[model samples]
Target: MAFLPTTKEEMQEQGYEQVDFIYVLGDAYVDHPSFGCAIITRTLQAFGYSCAILAQPDWHKDEEFLQFGTPRLGFLVSAGNIDSMVNHYSVNKRRRDQDAYSDDGIMGKRPDRPTIVYTQILKRLFPDVPVLIGGIEASLRRLAHYDYWDDKVRRSILIDSQADLLMFGMGENTIVEVADALNSGLAVQDICYIRGTVWKSKTLDMIVDDYILLPSYEQVRTDKRAYAKSFMIQYENQDAINSKMLIEAYEGWYVICNQPPLPLTQEQMDFTYSLPYERTFHPKYHYVPAIEEVQFSITSNRGCFGACAFCAITSHQGRVISTRSVESVVAEAKTITQMKNFKGYIHDVGGPSANFSRPACDKQQTHGACAKRQCLWPTPCPNLKVDHSHYVDMLDQVRALPNVKKVFIRSGIRYDYLMYDKDETFFDRLVQHHISGQLKVAPEHVSAPVLDKMGKPRKELYLRFVDRYYEKNKQFGKKQFLVPYLMSSHPGCDLNSAIELACYLKKIHHTPKQVQDFYPTPGTLATCMYYTGLDPRNMKPVYVAKTYEEKLEQRALMQFSYPKNYEIVYRALKKAHREDLIGNGPKCLIPKNKPKQNASFKQERAHRQKRYSKT
Candidate 1:
């Protein structure tokens, strides 16, 4: 299989006068399954449709969009694998210096909100052509969402981009269905019946299925409570077996989102991964940093059942688990061994939650996930089946393959879920085989109030898991460590809560190198709480650290060991009446007195000040 045509010359070389769809992207094209565009385009090709690549075209040039001479069916636009705003800026709203998705880690290759920019330009260039948008940016923003960068509620991306149709979720099936409909000459406006799609409607007259009317755009934009209510409704209705059509009204029109498409079965998953991907970036680029991590990685599954409050997987991929057969995975591993740059290692063989290899329970397959309940949060549901035998067997087969050295499960392991399983066969094997020096796990916070707000397990559960993990390592006679991912400044986390987390870190004897402040991105329950100061699950007012200084203090408290953070941590501890943690005792996070500046450093500082004064 050759790379897809990216230029007019390549299209001619492929003996095409025109292509069926021009896939406009916001990132450098890397034909790997880790990329959403590659999967969608390859799936279309498998169903006998032609697609031309338009990877990271110049947004300022009208001629760039006209290179393909207009797509026959329509134009497919995606803001790459990541949200454009997130790709361009950090949580602090600072412009990022490097873009891994661009050539050679260069920044500013694509415009911010490329889906809106590209679609608007396409509409201007070819007024009658259809424009379809999907990927993380479009999927999460399919409905009215709170934009952290804008600090305001923005209308649905479907409405803002003026796209004829928006496909959400893992769009393998949705894209083909829409492509078939378009190939059959159905108009874009009339193609609203497909699942996993959001389209604008002037009226709800043609709607026959049962539907729920969400709070209108005006209501959600004006009232925070209304926004929270709307988000909760959307959250509950993500399952395919039971979800209903959702309609959000605007002043002159309505945005109708059909129920999500069913998750891929084992056979379908096998076929999707079996597509003839070139498995590397297009030769046009010198390097793409994003491909390094995923080049040797294999996505064994799709969707996540552990719906963390701060994650967008439930909103996009739903809670149902779809996995490839062990045979399929082994076949991919064998293919990797044959590559020219093949090493003896397979980077990863996991997905969203590594150990989640099947549905939460039998009822989830038939009746759909419970709307108001969680599978593993608070406590594991009684009906939740705890089995890692299949995952163990799969790993066993992969590692046994020829030319394979070690298969690591780099994608997180849900410790609470792992602890629930009485059978220790998988746990024993995991400690024996998968540890690449350190196993990374997310214990977002230790405070019960903060953990509840973050939808994470309590401190006791995490401590128990940690104890068991170390015991396993001791039994295996391996010197492995646990790298716990921590977050600070989440909703319900006050100054005292931050101090509690700092004390817990002191008890654990681990200092995290990086501490992520709670980022309020769209399509998350945590973000809703951050914006509304109320948990959508229960309309109770929650304490939120909104100011810059407070958030900085919370972050500093997590990494209180660093000398640079001593002042901030000291101020935070004092503010929380935690002067007890400021002494030179074993439990103290910082020393009583600040470190004195050396004579040479003081002289250098004074010299710089003097020079500035003279100037």
Candidate 2:
């Protein structure tokens, strides 16, 4: 019989449960391998225990019923799917009465910033219950981290959340061992010897399993400036894993291996994606006919090929994309379709880099995906290439099915790849069935130097892609338009690059009218650049964006299109003497309303100094 907790206090009093366990919190959306949630959720599932993923739980009210509903098993605490900055993002979305900033991503997510609040509440309600924390939010915040969004180096999230254990990296191997040991009546200290895990010993000392000593997940978070240097050094060929670092340790009866993760079978992959309540949380939707689940509840592909510097795809899932076959994906889709009170809308069918559908080319399959290297770092391995043709076809396959009308991309598709296509037919088809009128594409930047630093090609490619897109749209007389995603203050971005970006947006007769002040997610080459001003894996000079003055300039360039921003734009243009864009001379194209600096000058100055020195 599978393990089951006798009761809540048994869980709290037992120090840690054995094999019978419950993963308490994480992933408002179903986790995918391409995303960090994949490693944590799938690893536990791999060890032969039926798992329940509580995507989003109501914390304000008593949720003890949820704890009792599951078989008594150890509980896993995760927010990797939703980072702690859940509030930072949500607050940015809310246009404060007098505030100037906002957020992007057309899916319209104004998540309750109560991630930590909910986590803490769960702790209070389940006192003494074994809580294991792991995921980007928990992992990266496991140690003092430089928060670009906060402009401060903060302490470990474990210290903040009071979680018992915070496993880092891919949590499968470590989490399995953790559950087994606790279930076997082992102490937390016994599990510390395992690699890629962070746990407080019985004595309450933080013991990070550092066998191979990979950079802690905390080291991955950074502001914009450090990322510039990172961009210069990260490239494709540098792709390599230090096999010399491999080692194993104990987690109950099983061994935790730091070696490359074993490839998952298509059946296992299907089963993982095919999980039910684990994917959706809205029982209301269980009865109501809505467009989609109110919050996140998705089952998508495992990995993506696009290695955009700003993305964490390759690091989390390896550069080689691993996915269930399209038939498996369709089967999972059918499950959602068959759910009670099902709506015709299937939320999304994409992964880390949405349009990214294929896996490793050649080098990765032979050399092994570098857990440490980045495709956008020093350069892309000619081998670390992405072919979106398969994904485009996948989109077609999903949408053409019976009883499914729309499938949105909550994840952003790779615009650079789509724009690079030599044919117009794909564009036509995408507009027809897939886009349903408007779609969001991340071009990141338009300046050549900035794009180069960001590991993006140039503005020309995006423009070419845009032209082709519109050509098809005009031909079809369709209004399905591309909403360009623009990022400001990235590693290589500056006031000049922002201005250049503004110029390009004008050429295309478009205005994002929305700007993303780049949030440096953990585990990307860019985060290293944004941290140490060079890729920690390599050293190289790079441009940076961190100054308040420069940020305003970038915003002005974006605001040149919106007349409402004219006061700021006019003053900014006059100050910069770029009156060439003032009046009707020409339209400056860029997103409007960059976020306000939610900080004082001293803190901001400290950040600028720290960022500038690295650059």
TM-score of each: 0.97, 0.69
Error in Å for residue 489 of model 1? 0.9
Worst 10 residues of 1 by lDDT: 606-615
Candidate 1 global CA lDDT score: 0.91
User: Candidate 2 at 538: error in angstroms?
Assistant: 5.9
**What's the CA error at residue 614 for candidate 2, in Å?**
38
Task: Kindly give the number of clashing pairs for every candidate.
Answer: 0, 34
TM-score of 2: 0.69
Over 1-615, each residue of candidate 1 has an lDDT whose tens digit, in order, gives: 998899999999998999999999999999999999999999999999999999999999989999889789999999999998988887778777799999999998899999999999998898899999999999999999999999999999999999999999999999999999999999998998999999998898999999999999999999999999999999999999889999999989899999998999999999999999999999999999999888888898878888688899988888989989999998998888889998888899889999999999989888988998899888888899998987888899999988888988898899988999999998999999987999999999888899999889888888899899999999999999999998888899999989988898898788888888888888999999999999999899999999999999999988888766889998988888889988999988999998765688678879877865664
Candidate 2 Cα RMSD (Å): 9.3
Misplaced by over 4 Å in model 1 are 596-615
* Candidate RMSDs in order: 2.9, 9.3
lDDT of 2 by residue, 440-517 (tens): 877788777777666675666667777777777788778777888888778777666666777777776776666777
lDDT of all the models against the reference?
A: 0.91, 0.54
Q: What's the true lDDT of residue 509 in model 2? A: 78
